[model samples]
Target: MVIHGREPDWSYVARSVVKVLTVTAALLLTLTVGERALEVFVDVGDRTAQVYGTAARIANPDKRLSHGYTHSGRLPVTTFTMRGEPRRAGPSDGTTEYKIVEGLFGTVQAPLLDGPSGSLADAIDSVEAKPGDGRARATLDGLPPTLVGVGVVEFAHKMTTEQLVAFGRRHKICGGDDVAYIYEPSFYDDSSDPSSLNAIVWNRDMTREDDWAEFAYQCETEPERALAEFRRWVGLLDENDDLEEFELAYGSLKGAADEGVTYGLVFDRWKLADLRKLLDDPDVGTIHLADVAFDLDTWTG
Candidate 1:
């Protein structure tokens, strides 16, 4: 075709051919890209639907998930650097290891349940450890003494590819896609002292001290579920000020200005079997647990 006021010359024809080829190439590229994009979109949608047990894609997928509480600026507890000590001469005396444990935690008990439970109290009293009873308490070492409040510091070891895929499938969080096969999505830091607000989820394979990952998979998948659980806990809170103070300390510690003192909770080996039993339950997904040094002492101070 002739240009505006241009002659129909060989140069014009050549330029027209180039322009036509360029336009045709661009259109083909656009269609190809669009078709490939549609295929990817359908694939992702179908897989996510399968994860959620839905027959179709739901509207507004992004808003529902609690993706790492982007506003919270939370960091991993495992990120805390442990002080390295020279190995002891006598078969590597795990003394320093235990001492560090003592400084951070008095005794590690897998509480039958989280919180100031009579069960936890009884667990403290009934532990089979020889001399760690009344006299033992968490020392002020290894932890920053001036910490104003406590937030949960969790050390979540990685999960196996199979387990992660299964968890994602069961929970409908991710479809075990390679990109989403990460521990970050499941990690949660409940600075809320109650620790009930943020619960611990045991890894199916509890190799690392049995408390592998405290990811809020439930919250990530169903954020409202956490709020509902929080409400239920609030309703259970007694009228006693002491109880309120303790829980309030837990829930609000995250808002503290500086790094507050955070302690640890260790699960005694004896209780692991029972915890595993609970984990096997179809209804139970994750348990509520914390690393904070609540009152582990059963004796008079």
Candidate 2:
């Protein structure tokens, strides 16, 4: 119908149509790939968050109760709820930040202490010792002996796992005859001077001598499992490469993994008087008083 234009240039029109079709197909393919990539990235992040809570709980076995993940602008924030306190950690403006507390008094932050390596006395002081009568009294004046307090009792020297278990059995809490509720064991070796190995938290709430004996058996027969569990949590230490403490912890563990956990034991519920009696034992080192649950019925697991 266009008699003036050289036969309507049919080839040019066909080439133009082909070029448009090719471009449209390429765009659709690119968009599909981009969407899938985005989904994969999000999925990975979600899984990481879930496992992070597990890792955090393991790393701070004595403290952290639970954890979750949220976002601040484009950065990710990990929130951990410990003993009714909420703490958030994340990267902010190229610097790591820990949101411990915010109130009218400004942010109150309790930074992690530097791990110490030195004499036993120096290492003992590294952990903040709660205020209590060094011998038999509770930290508070009105506190009763029935109120169970969690305490950490470090050993004076490395003991065989058998010896350690025997010690717990012998110096059992509650008149020195009842079964002791040992929650975890700190594997420390004096050979690994400067830093001690981390503690290995066992499954809690099983209050029986048989259960403890079984754990001792595992420590003696299956050292590999204990070491693996220790490494799993130690591997997830603060991402800032502040690994000297953890390294020392691991070294102490590995150095004496075969011998026994020499550092101490985390006794779940002990009367202050009972814990004090432990101080009299020649094998016992120092005791650090920790959480105090007032209600006798309160189950500390």
Candidate 3:
């Protein structure tokens, strides 16, 4: 121990100092590395923003086109609102000239022909009779009055259906009656693939009734048979995936039963294009899409 007191080895002291310096240098290097990594992340985020901006600009060359159509000054959404009620065709006067006021999707302003004022039977008569000329003939010849009513209702329903289809197409969402799912375009490799439209059918129905006037008159009268027919149509479409995106609807006169007067369906908005397409397919037949004036404001809400 006394020998150790004689100038403790300076070499050991020098080695300890070297060790501390080495550790300090390594710690400094680590801090520098961490700072560099953070800087890289920031740079990446900025670059991504720039790329997105450029892509958006390129995709929408016209500045005005970015917002798309101004649907009644609002974005389009799914909603149903009565455009207008069928006009009151006065009491059935046999000589009254009943005109097809609004075609299929039209609102009866005042009775066009002499028929019931507020009955489905009158609606049938009005629809059956020639527009303006007063010859009692179905708009689509050979179809019975009941069948014609169903077609009218189908037309109105199809408007809502087609809108849904268009929306699904735009968003690449698979639409059915029940569940619908949409995938972000960013997640897709080939965005054009129809499979990207992932959606499931929930339920659908369309119906028209000869007793619609009775049902209309007695609010409690359930149109079970008509509704069943509609459900059957929906079921058929559901089973066939190809028809899932197709339209469904109906139309009826306000006074079909009473006066034999013609008034357009209460809610008609079916499109002709869709009807044509449906008719072209062998699976479906001579269904007519009635025209109705839709409340643009409600549609866009």
Q: TM-score for all predictions?
A: 0.20, 0.40, 0.18
Which one wins on lDDT? 2
lDDT of 3 by residue, 175-292 (tens): 2211211100011126543322211111111121122333331111122222233334333221212111211011111111112211122212223333233433332213323222
Q: How well does model 3 score by local distance difference test?
A: 0.25
Candidate 3 displacement at residue 124 in angstroms = 4.7
Best-to-worst ranking by TM-score: 2, 1, 3
Residue-by-residue lDDT tens digits, candidate 2, 39-136: 33454234333333333333333432323343323322223222212111111123223222211111122233122122322323333233323432
Each candidate: RMSD? 22.7, 14.0, 25.1
Relative to the true structure, candidate 1 reaches a TM of 0.20
TM-score for candidate 3, residues paired by index:
0.18
RMSD of 1: 22.7
The residue-by-residue lDDT of candidate 1 on 170-239, one tens digit each, is 6443211111111121112477333332112112111111124453434233323322333333343223
Quote the lDDT for 183 in model 2.
22
Candidate 1 lowest-lDDT run of ten = 54-63
Q: What lDDT does the true structure give each of the candidates? A: 0.25, 0.40, 0.25
Off by over 4 Å in 2: 1-62, 67-143, 171-228, 231-260, 291-293, 296-301
Model 3 residue runs over 4 Å out of place are 1-84, 87-267, 294-301
